[model samples]
Target: MRFFDRTCLSSLLGASLVAGSLAATPVLARQPDGPVDLTAQAQPAKPAPTKPAPATPAPKPSTPAPSAAAPSPLAVPSTSATPVVEEPDTLPVAHWTLADAQSLLATIRGIGAEGLFARDYEPANLAAAIKVGEGDALDQLASRLFVWLAEDLRDGRTPMTARVQWFAVDPDQDNHPNAQLLAQATETHDIKGVLAGLSPKHPDYALLKDMLSKTKDPKQIAMIRANMDRWRWLGQDLGLQYLIINVPEQELRLTVNNQIIRTYRAIVGKPGRTATPQLAEQVRNVVFNPTWTVPQSIVVGEGLGARLIGNPRQAAREGYVATKNADGTITVVQQPGENNALGRVKLDMPNEHAIYIHDTPSRQLFAQPQRALSHGCIRAERATELAMTMAILGADLPPETAVEYNLSGKYTKVPMTKPWAVYITYFTVARDVNGVMRSFADLYGRDPAVIASFAKPRELHTSQRKSNEAVIKLDNPL
Candidate 1:
């Protein structure tokens, strides 16, 4: 009996050891610690969750939140009056005829209802897209299809986005998603199309969906659409693996395999300034104990700008100090540590704007419903693992050692063993989800330019995009 017990114990111990070993591997996913994943990432101090917001009181209609400007109600086009062109005779298609394609947009424009760009013409475009059999025309149709589906939720006539104004109108149903669009998406197998209609559960999903939907140039859309693809293709394209921060919708999705596996809230450069320029770049290295170099603009323009003069020591006390140059232009940088503005780690992605992804000590900001607040660089919630993930996705370096290197205060490149494809893109729409359309703030007002860029009576084409032709890789590669 003792011998039997010993053998059983040994078998259990062996099984436990195997499980532990598997958990240690990066391939295995551990439960997210409700914050950053330190076991597989870095030594990130978890931000405590804030108190639940007070139940939204019955809101006043004319009054917008004093913190920001209130946007007007979205104008949903009246499609109830219009009739769907019954094409019951036609089979679901992979392409659209040029006539069908032209008619999609042409008829809408001819109707003089510009507001119907996303909804009124979408079905037509989808039908037209299916009619196109070959070349870039098909690709253009796909892009348009992506854009329309994505935008309707965010920027188009479809109510894909959450409207704060709705609270004043329909308090009960405002928070409860009106599954008006979602029901339609459920009928399709197009994951991208459905995702394009994502709701408040993921607001940026709608914006990116729309951004993809409005593309006239297939080449551009195809590059950015990989993030929305139903397939996973990573490491096949070895190019500059830079950081991408899309500011308009406040969410940050880190991409590898041309897919977004990591996403979080980012506090971009305040819309009040051109400080955090909308752009993309390669992260040269990370600085653990980073020093914040205050820009001349902040010192010269802010109300407390001259505070560094009489009480320079006060600045240092708050983990900030002024770096005086011979030219008399002083730069204020925050010190690294608990008090540091950039919490612990900063992913250094190079671009025209000295903007990079960084951890913020102000975890309270994450709780805010509309988190479009930031000085310049992106203040990423759950940034520690994101930075660590960036290093691991492209480079083989252990996250611990990377943090140590940053703590050393020495700037160094987290080498990329495999290329990380980071695409910094903006679109008002997408089609990744259940047919719900999503929309967002036209942060740069790039919509008009985007609309103008649509192909001018261009022929429908579908040349296979070389960038998208890469072989799909498996998470557990065989």
Candidate 2:
């Protein structure tokens, strides 16, 4: 199977703009309701080194090896010829460290999110999104967006101990970004110069809200503030199509172009023992007729009873096939088929947590608002269709190949030709679902700090707001 990835975001900070007095100018940039301050240092993009491709010429055909001296007597035969340096594995790669991801997140000190928010693109966020085609840069960009779409509660299920998702946009390129960027760019460029110009009074939303209120380094703050603007101000207003879950509300929503398409009840993981960790990754593929592997924790713990009672026939009953390893340790694996615990499909978003999104036979659980009952993974309602949608993201996929799993047990590999992104987001502001504003049980308890950020007293606009962070309040408390 071939795999690739991409994001829907691009840089949005335009040339310096003036405050106020706006005329419909190039890419109408909307005036920010208030000043955007910068306290934390900006995260500068570092150029990555590229590996030069080897210049080896094609090898000429060789005569067959002699019988006695063939390779080696005890040498293990390579399972694969010209073995790839990267071992064949089922795990997803996580390149960003936790700290690297946290820098993009926001704190309660401000109203704006720290990383790229939908508001940045203003009038053009959606338009600009369209400009980003199926390129490698776009995939990296989308991966970054994944960080914002999904949250990592540090629950045992997912490996993102620090990174988190905040929004629920579509997992497809159905929406455009270039258009959105144009709309926002027009809004800001029209008011160049008069605007407060990213200052302490502006209170840059990156780092914590009080970053400027605490630090007093202008040079440090200036550069940091600049990137912060680019990151925060410019965003896809008609956000990407994604699956958003509000941890604070215990809700799940699928969105398309800012409009929510579906809402469902979800159970989050309990805090500590298996906190629902904030994570950002894409659903690369979906597994059909999936089987549940009782985690080691379960196998070694309470599940042993069920394993003993169920292990013998667990393969057939649970729709799995059992096999003992050379070490005599029994293992049960499930293949794609009806009656499979995974329902019909499962999304593959590799993270430290073996957590994944899959169809759940237990549809009733979705009705419950506090649905954090799984070991750590998410049991999605209508997950089979969701998988189908992922397959559809791969435009080249023959419609039959995309849905073939429903017809048979064959594993389907659909490469994203147009680039589809899946985000397990977590934003609790509500409004997107178009349903009555609902709150959720904080099963993972991610709100206290974020909620506290709102309640924390303010510090008078401090020189520190400029760049260097010392952790002080900005603006005198009311």
Candidate 3:
């Protein structure tokens, strides 16, 4: 089976606005009190500018005899001079003593406690690297382990292993300079503490770690491991406010300040070729009562074109408009209505896959326990509510306006006043509504790839891992 990646399509489709032939200026959601005028205010207007009165001339001073009682200006403290106060060093530093190295080595040996394989950190080799009285080797070992610890903490096994189309954003892209970590390790002499500092502090990460500690079933443990690693695939920070869709669970959540404010049931792409890919995009706007431009694959593959040609009356009855091209091909479009595939509203987030979050007439599908039943695009259960929420949160629209405005039969677009980040991801395990950790079905079969990646042997020592890091490329001197 072939997979259609949408990361590239996002760039191409993003260049053009989704207005179609509609006006560039979308009708703004009406404010209850109408537009504000900067001219009017409760405070009185400023007084008119007045010319200053002519300045009085100063009388010349007469020379006076020196008086011993008069104080000199030099006797006062100099205001221009700034006192330098030495600041105490507050930064954590590493103290790479034999004891410190052994402490870190203990954590490395117990890596399995963190839902990771202990073998991945090379126990035997690390044991050999941290010899007592070998100061140079101990220091080198500390640096190497620090680099490995940082990579595992920041990115989790390589991205390619998970087959995710991820791009570094925000905190993920922020460089974690090894030199700084190494220098701090040298000063603080707390190798274990320094390594712990590198781990992600997100609550979900902590929850998974807690779950890992108690989980005994190998299958469940593996699932948790996969999910934990998936978090590392995403950037360290998910932004102040963003939307995340879990394809496997068929759910969408609007998170603000790390709290989930709203959760909506979603219909994700079907398994196999139509599976939704893991990616990151930004929701730019909402299209109300949008027209569906049927893809040619659907037209020809589904025999829609031939059916329309055989019975022209069906086109009008189904709200389909067929346009014959110069090349003799026909293009079919479904008008906005209750029967429209994209229901009454659609969230606009351009991507190579031509996927978006939108309303769907097939609301009954949401009632099913398993909701993997879409053709790439996500069909939201509470599309109108989600749209209205987005309008108030990102489009600067009043709640009343978002709720009261009627779509009727028009194709209206509401551009976001401020775009919201949206991430499409896949995970086999996560916390449910009741906060109970649960495992989900691998609808797209992504778990195996992630699980396999974790199975790959890690670089034995920190120096080898750092030297082979993709973030650090050594160019040919030629």
Best by TM-score: 3
Candidate of highest lDDT: 3
Rate residue 413 of model 1 by lDDT: 50
Model 2 poorest ten-residue lDDT run:
152-161
Instruction: Answer with 1 or 2, whichever has the higher TM-score.
Output: 2
TM-score of each: 0.44, 0.45, 0.69
Using TM-score as the measure, name the better of candidate 1 and candidate 3. 3
Roughly what TM-score does model 1 have, to 2 decimal places?
0.44
Q: Give me candidate 3's TM-score against the actual structure.
A: 0.69
Better of 2 and 3 by lDDT: 3
TM-score, ranked from best to worst: 3, 2, 1
- Give the Å shift of residue 412 in candidate 1: 7.8
Candidate 2, residue 389: lDDT: 50
How far is 353's C-alpha from truth in model 1 (Å)? 2.6
Q: What tens-digit string does per-residue lDDT give for candidate 1 at 14-68?
A: 4322233312112223222122211222122322211212222211212211111
